[model samples]
Target chain A: MKKLMNVPNDVVDEMIEGYAAAYPQYVRICAENKRSVVSSKPVRPGKVGIVIGGGSGHEPAFMGLIGPGFADGAPVGNVFASPPPDPVLQVTKAVNGGAGVLYMYGNYAGDCMNFDMAAELAGMEGIRVETVLVTDDVASASKEEAHRRRGIAGGFLVFKAAGAAADKGYALDDVVRVAQKANASIRTMGVALSPCYVPQTGKPSFMLGDDEMEIGLGIHGEPGVKRGKLGTADEVADSLLSTITADMPLAAGDRVAVIVNGLGSTSQMELFIVFRRVARLLADLGVEIHRSFVGEFVTSLEMGGCSVSVMKLDDELAEMVDHPADTPLYVQK
Target chain B: MKKLMNVPNDVVDEMIEGYAAAYPQYVRICAENKRSVVSSKPVRPGKVGIVIGGGSGHEPAFMGLIGPGFADGAPVGNVFASPPPDPVLQVTKAVNGGAGVLYMYGNYAGDCMNFDMAAELAGMEGIRVETVLVTDDVASASKEEAHRRRGIAGGFLVFKAAGAAADKGYALDDVVRVAQKANASIRTMGVALSPCYVPQTGKPSFMLGDDEMEIGLGIHGEPGVKRGKLGTADEVADSLLSTITADMPLAAGDRVAVIVNGLGSTSQMELFIVFRRVARLLADLGVEIHRSFVGEFVTSLEMGGCSVSVMKLDDELAEMVDHPADTPLYVQK
Candidate 1:
């Protein structure tokens, strides 16, 4: 649970200041609200603005995803906590253009309520704002309760698609449509080998035995399928993907984008090993991996674990997924 | 000390397989030797080939640094252990286009000896090869013994400059010169908060108290400056930068590129907090930060800490640093 920080109270503020300074070419802090981080690149006058945000522990999610072809603005929260409505409103206003704006975030209760409130405020300002709740973590609920599932690393793809739509000058409604469609087709499941610490707190947020691991754990160390004896990379991949494929039902000839995302403390070495198993399993099922992303896209402090997210791709989704993105942490051409 | 892998002995082999599978568009294992990972993008005829490599465990260093506009090939070794001369020879043969090949790696004793042998073999085969040994880790030795200093994350910049030179059609000697200049201008220092366990050993590589940290730690568990009570991020960054600036003697009106590198388990949040202090310190000295890179550029398994690297930039080095590179773990335009 050790951390390298100054005063715990100053963690978020100082971190954001450092982030903006480190990535001056890509991001800037909002003048109205210090917590709101926006792309330095301006959005066109009539283009729909894409705004994505969530808790602060997920570094690249809310912050790293803001750039030329991704989310236009991001309102960062305290670690594992949702941002207040004011920052969200600030981000919405900053990124808003003549075509209105779209708000995308994980399907957490605090986030939904705060974002809805911000949307209402934006509406009063004559800006048409829409919301796309990313409910892509299949492990959070049964398939029958898919709408209730929480979002995890799979939201990376969901936001990527919406970002591409906004960058392509899609209308607000179209951007929301693409985000929702991407969310519906994506599923993620994660395993936690250890717990993480919140900066303000000096203790672990949760607990796990030395020889135990939680399959399908939430990003913030929420209960998973079950905490059991630790398994090998292959076994963990099989468990997570089996549940995901069962829920999404990928058949032969289906093309998909695979993300073997490290939660926090896990290394790329281990993530790629898990990805190797994921590739073999999918090939056995005769599914084609159109694209593969293996690294820490979304994280939870320094938690030790990883997640596997698969987004079933079609013509439109594939094109959006292939769109260019130039962000602080992620760049593609 | 828990890990996600099938077998201890198979860690390196399987990890390489996973890396090649995850980035099939960018890399492939050489047919002659599975340890040799070469770029999928073919090097043009008469272009000086960039062959970079070292031990495994540092996932993104050798492996991730191979792609378009980067290293043409990388011969991966077992965890924290150097590769034999054979794989290096295979990599030389695979990347040798017509102008010959350039070997770039850290200045470890094993790497120097092994790569030297490979260069001798390539010369016997009539392929002229030159080398640039990276010795940028200022913590390893004093300025008087700078040539004996080990390379750390600063090797990332050295290799990057050389890669751009090769991609820009620099001759073997020219690429070697660029890499050498980049190495001479760069300096790096690191701190370790805890120990990491190798897959095969299943034991901590070194030891540290719960409230202790080792300043000036190397990539492996090599001896560092000292072990003492852990300090705040600001204090640590100050200490590291003080030593580095004292060694390099940067003055006003100087421009430099900085890298705040996470060893392994350290999160980006902490790294940026560290980078924020680094920015402030450099600003106090009236130094211009040409660019800043804050993330896991190089690592040591799941070690918990970070390193700070700064490279003095002239127009030539700046262009080489800013050149486009497409790699699995890193990308830029």
Candidate 2:
């Protein structure tokens, strides 16, 4: 793969510089070692600050949502790679807000270890800190142990509810509770029709024949639970949603928000086709949809196929879901 | 070429039904013939209503931007097809608000004629209508005749600015001015790495080998101006940006917003790789970037490749672009 960089090592740095320059009005970086974009203006003095970090390829998730009512700071790592603890510490220190800092991100092993190290370092500096790892992609693990499902699309929902909780002056534990609740209620399953090529590798992570699809694929191109001849939209929707429903059954009259997220390479038309079946199936099961979004929300780089995420909502979750959010990633009213 | 639909012909309608059902709070139907979405609540009497429409497959574009400060209504047609005049007229009539409706969309010939006809019909009903067709695809037309270029990702910039202008209570002509300014200054160029298979056709829209890419391709699967071996992110960005800058010169001190959009199957990683090049190139050129968004904006089914868009900004354009706008498609502060 041809790239437009001085070298492969400079790619992430250059991208960050451009992103910082472009969104200066909304974000600013600390002079510290780890690259971090703090809110242009802090929310309040002596308030708990939220810092979210992860790999860089998922635009709008770790970067675009860095503003008020979201992350106070985001220390973005390179493509699919977690940032070092140094950057995490720098970002936490910059957005301390005098009260504390909350570290939130996906439940990746690399990320967990690095952020934990960063938290320990920050704590030594007398900065109070807490952490919540979002684990929402149910397909990553078995139904009996859904918590082990790697976090995928539900990162946004956790960020929204927790960010709002933080913005509403909730304490650190309360904010964590909101995020945990959102994560627990949210379930996602994905399929991969094609694989994405890592820039450094220049080779596809996986392969799928023209007539085949791997259901329950991981966002990072990990092997799925099943691979078979491609099925119809209804069948795919049923296959994916059945697992999600079995894990989190929405009783009749239950209200939920659905997200048919394209895993990078899938088209919106295909996502919506599956969404059509999802909506029909949910309605036939007597579930009421509050608000739904179908798009490439969380994605595996260039992978073909999509994931369906249903967030079982109560009045609180519904309000937060409907709350007006002004991020480059998503805006809802 | 695999699809999820049971039948190709019913795909569009089924998708619409799901869209309406999923987003009832944001959409409404008129007499069971027209589909529309409300951008703001408690419609402000005499406010200039902004209406945009196009084909259905371009989710969040023709329809997704319908929300506060952006588009009031978006009526979609079949996939990659223009909406009929009745729904256009109905959306215009429903959101007239006495100030008139500003019809904005891409510069496709079908859309141009049908929206023009709708404007004429709406005018006969005492509704003042002005239209601005986006011609921002610099690669498709010669520099001297860039206005004839087909609209692509650049439509997002124009839609955003017009949405903000309408929110500020700009009169019909003034809103038209913003849209025109955005269209004139914005430029986009796309390349397709693989051909897309239309659902109804079950065949490739265009043909290309595994090692090839078609540069400057249209979003509707139209052939690009050039076909050559697939190249690097830097090479692709340089080719697309050079054409855009040559057509819409970006001087040392000029501020602009950039959009690195996936044509469809391109991953965020690849898009970021492209954005990495684009940002560095613009920086080397000494251009100021006000904002940058990279993702799947306007897509062509599941075709792999990407497009780059740049919108030059003056003081007026910058303010409008920076202004608060909310839509299902995009949101900004």
Candidate 3:
């Protein structure tokens, strides 16, 4: 209830308005669909349009990534809630060039249903649209049930690959192929030390004992694999990496991109500490880190935790990962 | 305290080790000075070197800014503590090209004393060193005693201007002048809703009632001017902007760069809400926003609060702000 909001009910609208005002050069709210945020820079005609969407609490994730060499548009939703089909369709229509549009988002039931409906609506208008569900959270499912895993920070890598491939003028189908491939290669797991509050409800999405931590919690406070006493950064990193690598099985010579992402309230200082342990563990396992990112990328609302994600990279994915991107929240060159 | 640290006493060293590991591409620990982090990329000959240092908790500040077109070296200290003179001297020696070196840090007593000592030591070794203390926290002192005000997030602007000026091969005196000018043109203020715990202390820096907020709180949990019931984001933004503009009045034709920085725990969604109001207030006053930065730049561990910084821009400062620079945390082109 200590959030800096105007009214609990208006959090999403005010946030979107503020975001548009702050980054006028990078994005603008769609005139026809107030919930849709589209890049100010028009999408090139031949490039595949990348449309990303999800709930609104996770800043710079779905919307902040809309810019050149990134998502073409994002249909923002209420906090921890899915966007309606209207905004998704509108965003697709706004960003659809000569090529088709791709819908990428986390694997959530509400999100999947809404986006699917939007895709159907887009298809009725003769626009080609594809959907790629990110399911990289290793702790959410066993290897044989990978499709059941929920997406988390690893979606960033998938977005990067998809956006880069689209920027390279890949066909819509090829972009989807690369995105699916990137999705398959990435794995993520998180440890939650505290819970996050939802503005509308004025309550934490979940609760945890002060001395306990939950391993593999979802972005929206979904149940993780286990709850145990809080451990040191090194111990937590080991648990996350063990869970992730067990599912993905990284080899000594394999190259990968790593993300030590804060769940929300965790400090960058702590993330780096976790990253230190993760880097050493990976080195011992013979996995070469092609690039490393440590920060708050995807987050719950003021949750205290961190997640580790690894994207096993091939030459194509490596090139895509290195592709230049400029967005409000993240930038690379 | 529920912190992700191995040992409270080892937090500083572990944080430094993790930072070095995560960003080996940009920096490395100075062999002789374990406390100093010097850029892996050497300073160009005859360029005025920029050396920034402070406590270790503010990740991506003193150290993350060390790279091409930014700080050449950063001597890190323990949590919320100023670094010793030896490491500062070592960093100065390591990055001191033929020209000279600039020592930039917050206007704090311990830092000022230690850096002054470092400059004297560097002088003994025949290295030229100049200092610019950032004093931009309008809430910390009256306008008549602005020089006594504590430095805060506005220091980022001063650093960026100084680094850009030096990178452009400005003479030492010119670089110092520009840095001072940048510092003079910037002002900042913050509000804290909750306290951040120091790892070693295992207690919150300060205390607050559940529904209360402290306006103009310092980054290290220093007391602020007022404590009142938490208000809407717009109301908070109005109070912060009014205080800042009163000290450093802006004209209708003025242009400025604005940063709505989260102290640590504020969600990006809430930050945008604050920024929305900030933009409207500035626009109503006829001040043009040259650029907007909305994220955590300088932070206070996991403090729950935010600071707003405004740098009034003249043509020279505007150009310097627009200059291309890339660091781990910030990149502009």
Candidate maximizing DockQ: 1
- Which is the winner by DockQ between candidate 1 and candidate 3? 1
**A-chain TM-score of every model:** 0.98, 0.93, 0.98
Root-mean-square deviation per candidate: 0.9, 2.9, 1.0
Question: Could you estimate the TM-score for every candidate?
Answer: 0.99, 0.91, 0.99
Off by over 4 Å in 1: none
Q: Each model's interface RMSD (Å)?
A: 0.8, 3.1, 0.9
Candidate that beats the other on TM-score, 1 or 2, i.e. the better one: 1
Better of 1 and 2 by lDDT: 1
Better of 1 and 2 by DockQ: 1
How are the candidates ranked when ordered by DockQ, highest leading? 1, 3, 2
lDDT of 1 by residue, B154-220 (tens): 9999999999988998888888889999999999989999778888889998887788999888887
lDDT (10s digit) by residue, model 3, range B61-178 = 8888887677899999888889999999999999989799999999999999999999999999999999999999998888999899898898988999999999999999999999
Superposition TM-score, candidate 3 onto the true structure: 0.99
Give lDDT tens digits, candidate 2, residues A1-333: 322334566666666765565566677767886367677775587667888888876666687677667778888787788988998998888888777788888899999999999999999999988888888877677767765668887787778877777777778877777778888889888777877666677677777788888987877766687888888888889999998898888889999988887776676767777888898899899999887887766676666788888899988788667666555455554
Expressed between 0 and 1, the share of native interface contacts present in candidate 3 is 0.71
Candidate 3 lDDT score at position B323: 83
* Candidates sorted on TM-score, descending: 1, 3, 2
Q: What residue runs in model 3 are displaced by over 4 Å at the alpha carbon?
A: none
